[model samples]
Target chain A: MLEGILTGLSTATMPVNLFMVFIGCFVGTFIGMLPGLGPISAIALMIPITYGLDPASGIILMAGVYYGAIFGGSTSSILINAPGCSGTVVTAFDGYPLAQKGQAGKALALAAYASFTGGTISAVFLLVAAPALASVSLSFQSADYFALMVLGLSAVAAFSGKGNILKALMMTVLGLMISTIGTDRSSGVDRFTFGRMDLVDGISFLLLAMATFALAEALMSVLKPEDNGEADEDAMRNLGSMKLNKEEIKEVAPVIARSSVLGFFVGVLPGAGATIAAFLAYGFERNLAKAKEKLKFGLGSLKGLAAPEAANNAASSGSFVPLLTLGIPGSGTTAIMLGALISYGIQPGPRLFLDNPEVFWSVIISMYVGNIVLLILNLPLIPYISRLLAVPRQVLVPMILLFSITGVYLVSFNSADILIMVIITVLAIVLRLLDFPLAPLLLGFILGGMLEDNLRRALLISDGGYSFIWERPITLTIFCITLFVLVAPLASGMWKKYRKKTVGYGASMQE
Target chain B: MTISRDQIAGLVFLVFSLAYGFYATDIALLPGEEFEPINARTMPYVLSGLGAALSFFFVLASWRSAGTLKPLKLGLMAWPPVIALLVVMVIYGLILNWLGFVVSTALFLIAGFRIMGERRPKILFGVSIPFVAISWFCLTQLLDIYLAPGRLFSLLGG
Candidate 1:
């Protein structure tokens, strides 16, 4: 294990690989700085570029973008009250208020340091935990894997959007249905291609990603431009020193440490990602604080600045665990990363440790390098980086559209793919307009193939006995967990209503 | 006549699911595998049936919840720019071979910028031209991928 780690470090340090890391971070920061763009789109846009490179370099570059974008997301949150990504939404709650108080530099500094610390800590956890988990999963059978995939799909229904779990679950089912659109490998028979030659390969991952994230996002902005607030000139003038005083450091370090550990664990769960981690950390800190200190939350507390900033960055790293060990992506951005891995002909799973140790370790080590590169780039250059908010949407949106078109075209040099991209983009826009969550759709699509394969394999092993699922302890436990996750939300909602009603009755009695 | 977004979504998906389920039945099993418990068609049928049932439930839920409310409809003024952008993109995709990468991209950008309310033609031409040139150079030269020069470029003849 030590030798593998050292080998990964050496490979990541090579000149070409190191250069790709720098480029990924730089571009990722810019992408994250853009108001309407997020890490998912940034990663998607880079997929075509990574096509020609070696697997290690390709993944290193994409991973760099993932972390760099998170770091850059805090810049927009603090300066403009526009979190460049969803994960940075909680950061803006107090981050912007701090900027308004002439503490922009302090807020940004705390964010930078906290992000670095959290990321580095999470990477260490990943380095230790992923391998251990992978070895354990190596003992898993087909039944166990199918149950695990079911758990993953169910968790998406639990964690996505606030409106309706039923709606999310339906979208997931639709995604799975869409995944059935090509030739079945075992049967050599077409399933749902509808006789189109293009459908033989099923849908292209890049095309779907570009349409859903980049193109759909641009079109939505055009339909109704977001009211992204501008940075305050007065606050810009008081862009105070980036240095944290000793007192501030003493207060923030422990919060950063606590949130990093907390966020990493949250991120390790399927369907939960940075946004949940950030909110959890923020709430945890507020609840733990004394009354007077608690009042400072959402009102520019330094602890507020540190908690979510650290947690979200840590959570991004934490989300990598299941992707590496189980071959199931825990979030939307990681789903795209999983797609990139598969595109390179590398299968990610328990056997990845034995079959493709180089790909796994190098990506793991690149996170360490990426976090350092982001901290160094963001701390001093933050003031300038925030200026990206001022770029006109007319210019930025058009350029992004061009890149989406060209990137998809370059993958196969086929204009037919471009047409398919446009059609999908239109479908994505209609779905977004109706408030259908795209993340579940994407999660369903990515995991569906593996789910079907495992289901079939398990049944074959059992000679068509469905009892094998419950017969196996591992599979049974996973199904139980899935049932709990799905039911917990409904149970909690009812409990909250019950508590509210009882409290209301008590108040009426007193009156 | 006035359906909520959720209702429309549910109806569309429900119809889609039924079609998917019906079509999946036609997927033939591998030779001598007809008696197999799980085959290629099994997952698709199960998934589509579940999808159809869930979508039906969704439609009923939305209809029940939405007793009498509707979001303000988008005014006619809200759509031209978006429609124009989409149209320009379709045209651009159609013209790329005939007019080539540089020409079509430049034209698309100019139209796109104008439609988005960028009024200055100088700024429009300046940004669009340089962008197309640089991207063309990067993809064709640095990346060593070919972007067609177009029929127009061929007609011009060096």
Candidate 2:
């Protein structure tokens, strides 16, 4: 393990890799600070650009963008109460209040420190944990692999979105069907291409990503033109000292430490990401605070600001575990990263350690480098980064649209790809309007090919025996878990109703 | 009976699954692999079947529910503008090869900004021109990828 870490550090030290990380973080922070743009779109737009680079460089760049966005998001949340990213929404609850109280600098500094600490702690956990877990899966057979994939898809569908589980499952199935297009691998024949030559290669991951996330998000912004009503240019002054005194540090240190552990574990789970971690950490801290000081929480308490900041950053690192070790993404952003990895002809899974240890380790080491860089960029430069909030949607939207188009064209050099992207974008916008969560659809799309390939391979090993799904112990255990995950919510919902009815009946008899 | 959003979504998925299932049946198996336990058509068949069942479940869940769905509020700048923007994007994609990156991007941005209510011509050109120019230079020079220089440039014999 130590040797692998050293090897990774050396790989990450390459000048090109280092430069990509810096540039990615800088650009990611700049774009991610915009009100409507987030880490996903920022990384999505960069995917085409990274096509010209090596796999390690591309992965490094994307990781930097992910971390940078988390850092940049806190700036807007603190200064203007508008979270630049979804994960930062919890930060804005108390961060903006601190800014209102003339401690914008203090709030921003606390966020930078907490984010750095949480991220680094999680990075340590990832370094120690992912390899150990991957080693266990190294012995997994095809049946076990297929069962694990099913478990992953089920967890994501059940937990990621707050909407109806049936809808998420339907979307997951739809994504699986979409993956079946083009050629049937086993038969060596086209299945659903409908005679279009381009469909022979199946749909490009770039097109699906851009259409669902970047262009769809851009089109939705155009349609709604969400009122950026919270940005108050007048309150942008008096960013008091960025330095946190010893006493203030003492107050937030434990909160950051506790939340880092909580956030990292939640992140390791499929379907739970930084957004949930942040909210959970914040609520936990609120409950921990004293009654007299509790009221100060949402009104500018430093502890309130630190908890979510720490958790969200930690959660981002935690989410990488499943993607790297299991080849299953825990969240939407990581799902995009999984797609990026596959585009480079690198399949991420348990064998990733043995097959591409350099890529795995370098990516892990780069997180340490990226977090330190983010802390440096965020501390003193935050005041200026906040000015980015003033950029209007009208100006930003068209530019994003142009970038998406140009980027897609540059990747394929085919005009048809761009048209397809636009069409998919329109369809995605309609889906979004109807409140169908797009993330699960994306996760499904990414995992579908692997799921089918493994399922078939497992059956081939069994000589067409269908009973291996439950006959193999490991596979059976995973299937049982998937089954429990699917039914748990309904079971719990019914249990609560039954308890409530029984209690009501008992009370009436007493009366 | 009025359909809710979930019902509409369910219907869409149901129709798509039925169509997909029908298509899966016609996919031919590989030679000598006809009796194979698991073949190319297996997963798609399973997924389509699952999709049909799930969508039916969704429709049933939505059907027995009793709450008012949120009214679709197409605010001030609504459907017409959105539809118009989509048309503009489609046109931009169509002319991109002919008009070149610079010209097409410029025209798209100008039209897009105008439709989104950017009335200031100065700010419009100021942002659009520099962005288009820099991105073109980076793609062509830095990345060594070619963007179509357009018919006008070709006609000028550059």
Candidate 3:
């Protein structure tokens, strides 16, 4: 472990990697400050640029962007009451109120402090946790892997909130269906090309990511046109003192610690990610608060703003655990990173650290470095970054549109890809309107090939019998977990319904 | 008689799955490969069934809540710009081969800016052309990447 840390320190401290981290954070902050472009889209936009670099630098750049974007989102949420990403939505609840109260600088400062602590703490926890998990998972077999992918896919839907469970699952199925479009690698059999040569490769992950996320999101935002930057400009003029006196620090200290720990654990869950982590931490803090403090939560309580800022950052750090150890991305943002890592020809799984120590440890170390850079660099630069983001949507949106399309075209040099991207963008916009979660679709598409390969291997090993599912204890345990994850939600929902009926019947009897 | 948005989604997916399943049968398999435990046909068959089943359940669930669920409504969302932008993107795609990277991208950005109500020729021409030129330079000179010259240029050169 010490040796690995040293390896990471050496790689991450290199001038180029450090520069990548800086550039990533700056760009990430800029993009994340833009309403409607979340970390996923930010990361997606970087995919093309990162294609020119080495794997470690590429990933380092992305990790920095991920953290920077989250921090930037909080900036928007505080200053303008418009959250740049879902993870920072909770930040705005208290943050915007604080900004309105002439404590915009304080809110920004506190959010930055919370994020730095959260990121640093979780990076430490990850330093200990990731290697242990990777070593254990090194023994994962085909059956176990198949079960794990299913669990990951199911968890995405199960955790995608209440009404969209079925829709998310449908998207997952659609993703899988799309994944089967190209020829089958194992048997050399063409499946769904429909005689089109472009169809043979199915779809490019970069293109899908760019289209569905960057292009679709940019276009989707265009559907509801933005104001002429008046609100942002107004908010920028009065930024109050950034200093947090001893009293303010003391008040939020425990909240930050509690939320950071809670956020890390939630982020370690397969699909919970940072948004849920921030929400959970906010709720938990509110519930723990005294009556007076509780009332102050949405009215700009220091603790309230600090709690989510800390938690979301911690959760963001915790998310990388699965990506490194299990090769399953915890959320849509990480899913795109997973796709990028795969394109770099580096399979990030149990073998990640063992095979690519520089890549692995460098990423982990760069995350911590990225956090420091954000605090020392971006916090002070927020006002300027926000102003830059005020570039009118008329100009900004088209530039983003240009980048989104050209990003794909440059990679393949195929004009047809541009056309295909248009189709996918339209489909993505329609699906977004219909309220289908597209993350699962991307995750499913990414995992589809691996899932099929594992299942096929498991079947072949068992002589075509399904017994391997139950035969291997590891596989059985994973499948059981998947079953629980899938069934528990429905069972609990039904139980609630039954309880409601019984309660209603008793009320009727009394009447 | 009002099919909710969820129902429409479900119905579309259901039809897609059925069509996908139909096509799954047409996938060519090596002789004796079909007997294998898992082949090209295996995943498609499973995916189609899963897709069909999920969509069927989704449609049924939506239908069960027919009165409660809202019908599909996209009227409030601004349509002209979205439609224009999408068309602009499609045209951008078409013109790339004919006009090359610099001209087509510049045109696309200018047009996109115009559609979004940026009428100032200064902002439009000034931003689009220079940006495209810089990018073209970066790709061609810095990255040493080849952006194919326009087809018209190629014809002239030949």
Clashes of each: 0, 0, 0
Q: Which ranges in model 1 have alpha carbons more than 4 Å from their true place?
A: A228-238, A498-511, B1-3, B67-73, B76-78, B151-158
**Consecutive 10-residue window with the lowest summed lDDT within model 3 chain A:** A224-233
In candidate 3, what are the lDDT values of residues A204-278, reduced to their tens digit?
A: 988998898899989888896555356556767778788999999999999999999999999999888999999
Against the true structure, candidate 3 has what lDDT? 0.90
Best by lDDT: 3
What are the RMSDs of all candidates, in order? 2.3, 2.2, 1.4
lDDT of 2 by residue, B18-133 (tens): 99999888877778666887777888889889999999988888887625567777565467767877788889878887888899988999998887789998978987888788
For candidate 2, give the lDDT of residue B64.
Answer: 77
TM-score against truth, every candidate: 0.95, 0.95, 0.98
Q: Tens-digit lDDT track for model 1 on A1-511?
A: 9988987888899899889888999889888877667899999999999998999899999999998888888887887787888899999999999998888998988998999999999999999999999999999998998998899888977897555787889878977887888888678788888888888888887888899998888777788766653346556556887889999999999999999999999999998889999999999999988899999999999998899999998999999999999998888899899989999999998988889888789888989889888888667776776666567878877888888988887777667777788888889888877777787888888888889889888998998989977898888999999999989987897899899999999999999
Error of 2 at B41 (Å): 1.6
- Residue A150 displacement in candidate 3 (angstroms): 0.5
Note the Cα lDDT for every prediction shown. 0.86, 0.84, 0.90
lDDT winner, 1 or 3: 3
TM-score of 1: 0.95
Docking class of 1: medium
TM-score of 3: 0.98
